[model samples]
Target: MTAASPPSASRPRYAVYVVLVLMVAYMLSFMDRVLISLMIDPIRTELGLGDTQVGLLVGFGFVLLYSIMGIPFGAIADSGNRRNLMVGGVLGWSAATAVSGFAGGFISLLAARAMVGIGEATLSPAAYSTIADRFEKRKLGFAVSLYNMGVSLGGGVAMLFGGVLVAWAMATAVPLPWGELTGWRLAFVAVGLLGVPLAAVMLLTVREAPRRQGGIKPPPLSALWALAMRHKAAFAAVVIGYSILVIAAYGAMLWAPVHFARAHGMSPAHLGLAFGVIIGLFGTVGLAIGGLLSDRSAKRGHPDAPVRIVLASAVLQFPLMMGAYLASDTTVALVLAAAGMATVSTIGGLQAGTLQILTPASMRGRMTAIYLLVANMAGMGLGPLVTGFVSEHLFDGPTSLGKALALVTAVSLTIGVALLLLARKAIIAAVLDNDRAEAEAG
Candidate 1:
C-alpha cells in the first residue's frame, strides 16, 4: 500500500480562523444544549411540573434524538458539504431555541429541546472530520482541544449567563413584546438568536479542507462498517466509557445550581457564577493540558496515553466528587467540585484524537456519530435523569440530593475506570497499528 503523504510542515494562519469559527459554533451548540439547566426551576414552576419531568426534558428529551440522529448526519457529513451541514445545524438549533421561549407547556418545551438536539447532532462528527482534514496528526490534538473548549466555555457561559439572564428577567417584570413570555423564555430567545449570525459567519468563513491525498476512495458506508468491525472493542469501550462519564458530568452540571441553592441557601445567580468560573477556567485548562500531554506521549510512542489519562482521571475523580458531595462547607465543596471538573474534562481531547487516529479519514464522521450516539444516549441522556431519579426516590429529600448525585457519579466513574482499564491494551494496539499503517502508506 502506498503511504499517505505527510501534511504541510508549517500550519497556516487560516487554521486559526478555522479553529475560532469551530469554537464559536461549538460554544453555541453547547449553550443551546445546556442553558435549559439554569432555567429549570422557572420552567418547572411555570409548567407545574416535577423534577422527574425537568430531568426528562433536560436529559432524555434532548439527548435521545441528538444521539440517534448523529450517525446519519455524520455519514452525510463525510460525503456532503460540511460547511452547509454546520450552518444548517446552527440555524435549526437556533430557531428551536427561539421557539423554546414561546413554549406554553411541557410538550412544546420537549419538542423545542428535541429540535435543539437534532441541530446539534450534525456538529461533532463533521467538525472532527474537518479538523482532521485540516491539521496534521501531530497538531490534531491541540486543534481538537481548542474546539472542545466550547464544552467548557459553553457550560460556563450557560451557567453564568443563564443565572444573570434569569435574574435580570425576574427583576425586570416586563411583559414580552409578543405576549406573557417569562425570563426563561427570553433567555432562550436571546441565546437562540445569537446562533443566526454565527451561522452566517461560519458559512462565509470556514472552508472544508481538501480530503487526504492518494488513498483509494473506499465506499463510504462499507468503509464505515468495516472500520467499526475492525475496532469494535475500542469503539465500544469509548462509547460506553464516554457515555458514562458524560452522564456524570451533565448530571452534576444540570443539578448543581439547584443543589447549591437548596442545600446551602445560595442564590441562583451566585451559584451560576461560581460554577461557571470553575468549569470555564479549570475545565478549559484541564482539556488543554490533557490534549498536549497525550499528544506528547503519543509522539514518544506511548500508544496507551488516551486510556491511561482517562483511567487516571476516573480514579482521581471518584474521591474529589465524593468530597464535593459530602463536604458541609460551601467553599470546600466548590473547590473540590472544581478539581473534579478539571480531572474529568481531560478525556475530551484524548477521546476525539484517539478516534481520529484509529479510523480512516472517510469514516471519521460516521465513527464519531456512532461514538456520540452511545455516549449521548447513556451519558447526556441518562446522567441528569438518573441523578434526579435517585435524588427523588432513593434519597427522599433535598438534604440527600447531594449524596445521591455523589453516589451516582462515583458509581459511574468506577464502572468507567474498569472499562477503560480493560480497553487499554486494545487502545495501545490500535494506535500502534494506525501508526504503522500511516508510516507504510506515506
Candidate 2:
C-alpha cells in the first residue's frame, strides 16, 4: 500500500468535497434510474404494458446501453478529464430522464430509458478510478463504501420522493401546472430537472482529482484481455460470482414493491415509506459494517479481506431472501426482506475496492468498466426480465411473484457462493503479488 501522496495529504478536505460531489451525482443518477418502479402501475395502465414489458423498461432498456458504453467511457476516464466526462453524462442523463415524461408508449419510453443508461455508464468507473487515487489503500474500502451510501440513499429517496409526488398528483384540484402532467409523468419531470443544477455544480465546483497513474493513453482491449487472463480466477470470482448475486439484488429492487402490491394488497404510498426506511437505514448500515470489517481485517494483514467479506455477504443473503420471498405475512416478509437488503448491500463497493488493490493505476478505470459491463448486463439487465418471465409463464395468479423471487434467490446465491469460494486462493495470491509490486515502486 502506498502512503498518502502530497496532494491528498495536504488537501484531505478537498478530497472529501470531491467525494461528496461524486456521491451527489451517483445519488441523483439512481433516483432517476429507479423512480419508475414506484409508478409501475400507472405507467402500465397508460402504456398498456405487461409484466414482461415493465421488466424490459426498468432492466434491459437502461442496462443495454449502460453496460455497452462502460468500457469506452472508462478508457476516457483513464486518460482524459473525468470530471468533464461526468459533466456531460449528468447533463445527458438528466435530459433523457426529462424526456421520459413525454414518452407515450413502449418504444418511446424504452428509447428514453436507453439514453439514460448511456449517460450513467460514465459515472462509476470514473468515480472509482478517482477514489482509488485520492484515498490511501488503508482507507479505500471505507471511502468507496461511503460513496456507495449514495446507492442505498438514492434508492430510498426515489421511493420516498415518488410517494410524495404520487400523493400530490392524487390530491390535485385539477391538472398539474405544466402540460397538465400528473402522477408518474410529473415525477419524471421533477427528478429529471434536478440534474441541471447538479451538473452545474459538478462543472463549476468539483476539480478533477490528479490521476495517480500519470496521463498516458489507455491500453487497448487486447492488452486488457491479457491482463484479465493473468488473474482469471480472481477476476471471474469478483465479476461472475458477484454478478450471480446481483441478479437477486437488482431483481428485488425492481419487483419488491410490486410483489407487495400484487400479492399482499399494499399500496405504493404505504409501501414507499416502509421499504424506503428499510432500504435506506438497513442498506446503509450494511455498507458501513462491510467497509469497517474489510478495513479492520486488512489492517490485521489480510490483503484479501474485501473478497472474503463479499463472499460471506453473498452467503448470508440467500437464506434471508428465501425467507422474505416465501413469508406468509406482509410484516414478516418486510422484516425478512430488510434483513436480506442488509446482507446483499454488504457486498456493494467491496468488489471494486478489491479490484483497486489488484489492478495497476493506469488501467483501473477500464478494469472497473469491464466489471460493470458484465455485472450490470448479467444482474441489472437480466434479473428483472428473468423474474418477470418466470412469473408470467410458470406461475399463475398475483401471488406468484413471491414464488418466482424465491426460486431465483435459491439458485443465484448458491452458485455465487460456490464460485467465490473457488476464487479465494487466487485472490489471495494476486493481492500478495500486488502488494509486493506497490512496495517496490514506493
Candidate 3:
C-alpha cells in the first residue's frame, strides 16, 4: 500500500483568519436572529399584538423556513463553493432584514423574518464543514468552540449595543433617505445592511476547503439517509438531546429580556447590558472551558469526550436555569442566568465538533443540515412559542414569564441529560468504526 500523504503546511495564520471571519458571520446571523427579542415590547405595543404572536414571530416564522431549507443548503455546501453560498446567503438575509424595517404589519414582518431564517440557514453547515477541514482532530474542539463564540458575541452585541442603538433611534428619530423610521424599524434596517459589505469581504478572502471526498460527488439524499439509518441510535440521541436542550435555551434567550422588563422593570438599555454580560462574557468562558476540556480529553484517548463534556454542562445547567427563573430578586435572577448561560454555551461548539468527528468529511454538511433541521425546528421553533403559550394561556399574565420559563427548562433539560448519557456508547462505537475504516483505506 502507498504511504499516506504528508499533511498540508498551510500557515496557522490563515486558519485563524478564516475562523475569525466565520465567527463574525455567525455573530451577525445571531444578532439578526435575537434582535427581535429586545424589540418585543415596542413591536407589540405598536402592532396591538400579544405574546403568542410575538412568539410566532421570534420562533416559528424564521425557524420553519430555516429548518426546511437547511437540508438542501447543507447538500449544496457539501459540494458547492461554500464561500459563494455564504455570500449569497448573507446578502439575502441582510436584505430581508432591511425589508423588515418596512413592514406594515405582523404578516409582512413575519415574512421578512422568515426570509432572514432562510439566509441564515446557509451559514452553519458550510462554516462547520469548512472549519472541520481546516483544523485537525485534536484541535477541532477548540477551533469550533472559538467559532461558536459568535453565539455569545453576537448575542452580547445585540443586547449591549442593540439596546443603545434602539434607545438612540427612539430618542433622536434620526432621519434617513427612507424617511424617519422608528427605532425598532431602524434597527432592523441598520443591522441588516451591515451584512452586505461583510459578505463581499468573505467572498474576496475565504476559500473552500479541499473536499475530503474529492472526485466523488456528494451523495444524494437517499444515500445520506441510508448512512444516517446505519447509526440510528446515535443520531437519535444527538438530535433529540440537543433539541431538548435548545428548547430551554432558546425559550429563555428570546424571553429573558421581556422577563426582566416585566419582573424587574428595567429599561431596554439596562436589560441589554445585563443580559449582554450574562450571555456574552459568561458564555465565552464556558465555551473556552468546554473546548479545552474536550480537546484534552480527546488527546488523552477519550473517545466520548465531547458528549461527556456536554452532559456535564447539562448537569450544571439544570440548577442554574431553575434558580434563574425562580429567584425573586432581580440581581439573584441575573446571577443565576449568567451561570446558566455559561453552561449552555458549551452545547453548540462541543456538539458540532462531536458531529464532525463522527461523520465522514464528505457527509459533514448534510449531517449538519439534518442536525440543524431537527434541532432548530424542535428547540428554536417550538421553544419560544410554547413558553409564550404557557404565558398567555396557562398563566394569563405577563408576570407569569418566570414560571413558564422554569417549566420548559425543568422538563426539557431532564430529558436531555438522559438522552445524552444513552448516546455515549453509540458515539464511542462510531468513533472506533470510523477509525478502523480510515486505517483500512490508508
Candidate 4:
C-alpha cells in the first residue's frame, strides 16, 4: 500500500475559521457553565439553601458526568466526525441550560446541570484533536492560546451579562419568565439560549478534517494506556499538576463574587463587573503572552518551554492568590485577583501544546481524554467542593472564606510548581523523542 500524502503542504487558511468556530462553541460552553456562579446568592436565598448545596450544584453535580463521559467522547473524537460531535455537544448543553431555567427545585436544577456536564464533555477533546490535526506544531501553542481565550471571555460574559440581567430584573420588577424563576435561573436561560446560535454556526460551517491522513487506525485504548504507563512521570505530572491548578482556579471562580460581595460589601453588579473585566482582560493577555513565549522558546530549541512557563507562572501565583485573599481593600483585592488569574491562566495554552507534541495524531484524543478525566475529576470535581466545605465547616463563617480560600490556593500553587518542575525533564525528553521519530519517518 502506498503512503498517504502528508496533508497538503500549503496550510489551510480555513484553519483559522475552524479555530474561530471552536472558540465560539467553547465560549458558550463556559458561559452556560459559569452563569450559575453569578446567580448563586439569589438562588440560595430563593431556594433556602446553603453554601454546601450551591457548591454541590456547581461542583460535583456538573463534574461527575462531565469527567466520566469525557474519556469516551475523546476516544470517539479520535475516530469519528469531530465537527458533528462538537455541534451535537453544543446543542445538548444548550438545551440542558434552557431546561435549567425552568427547574422548580434543588433536585431538578442539579439534574439540568449534570446534563450540561454530559454535553460539554464532548467539546474539548474533539476541538483539541481537530486543532492538532489542522495546525503545524510550531503554531500549535499560539493557536491553543487563542482558543483558550474563550474561557476567559466566556467567563466574563457570564458574569457581566448575568449581572446585567439580574439588575434588569430587579430594576424593572418584571415578573421572571416563570413565576418562580428569579435570579440564577434567569441567568441560566439567557446564557443557555446563546448556545443555539453558536451551535447552528458550528453545524453549518465547520467541516471535520480527515482523520488519520496516513491510513493509520485510531490507537486502541490499550495503546493509550501503555503510552501513559511508559511515560508515567510525564503523564502523571501533567495531569496532576494541571488538576491541582484547576482546583484553585475553579474554587476561586466559584467563590470570587461571593467573597467580594460579602467581604467588601460590594453590590452584585459591581462585583460581577470587577471580576469580569479583570479576568476577561488580564486573563486573555496573559494567555496570549504565554503562548507567544512558549512558541518562541520551542523554536529556540527548548521543547519544555511551555512547561517552564507554567512552572514560573505557578511560582508567581502562590503569592498573588494569597494577596487576593488577604487584601482588605476591594481595589487591592481585585488587582491581586487579576494578577493571580493572569499568572495561573498562562498555563492554559502550554498544557494543550505539550499534550499534542507528546502524543501521536491517532492517540491525541484518547490521551486528551485521560488528561481531562484526571484534570476535571480533581479540579472541577473537588476544587469548589473542597473550598465550600472548608469555608462552611472548617472556617464556619463568611469572614473566614477569603482566608480559607487563600490558604488552599497557596498550597495548591506550591504543589503545582513542584510537579511542573519535576515534569520539565520528562516533557523535554518526550518532545525530543517525538522530533527524532518524525525526522526518521520523514
Top candidate (lDDT):
3
Q: Global lDDT of each model?
A: 0.79, 0.84, 0.85, 0.80
TM-score attained by model 4: 0.95
Q: Which ten residues in a row have the lowest lDDT in candidate 3?
A: 1-10
Candidate 1 per-residue lDDT over residues 131-187, each given as its tens digit: 887777877788888888899888888887878888876666447576665588878
Task: Report the number of backbone clashes for model 2.
Answer: 0
lDDT tens digits, residue span 22-114, model 4: 887888888866667777887888778887888888888898999889999998888888889988999899999989878878999899999
Q: Candidate 2: global Cα-lDDT?
A: 0.84
| Tens digit of per-residue lDDT, candidate 3, span 1-442 | 1222212225567887888999999999999777888888999998889888998999899899998899899989998988888889999998999999889999999999899999999999999988877777788899999999999888888988878988876776657696888779888888988997899899889877665556566767787677668877787888788888888878767887888888788898898899889878998888888999999999999988898899888888889888888788889889999999999898767978888877777788999998889889888789888998898888745469988998988999999889878778987888777667545655
lDDT of 2 by residue, 1-442 (tens): 2232524756888888888889889989988766787889989998899989988998899999999999899999888889999999999999999899888899999999999999999999999988888888888888898888788888888877667777786565346455577667777877899999999999999888776645345667787788778888988888898788788888777788888888888888887887787677788888889999999999999979998888888878888888887788989899988988887778975878888888877788998998898889888788888898899999998778888988887888888889989888998888887778666645
Q: Which residues of candidate 2, in runs, are more than 4 Å off?
A: 1-6, 170-179, 215-217
Single out the weakest 10-residue window by summed lDDT for candidate 1: 1-10
User: Which wins on TM-score, candidate 1 or candidate 3?
Assistant: 3
TM-score of candidate 2 against the unseen true structure: 0.96
lDDT, candidate 3, at 146: 93
Instruction: Return whichever of 3 and 4 wins on lDDT.
Output: 3
Clashes of each: 6, 0, 0, 0
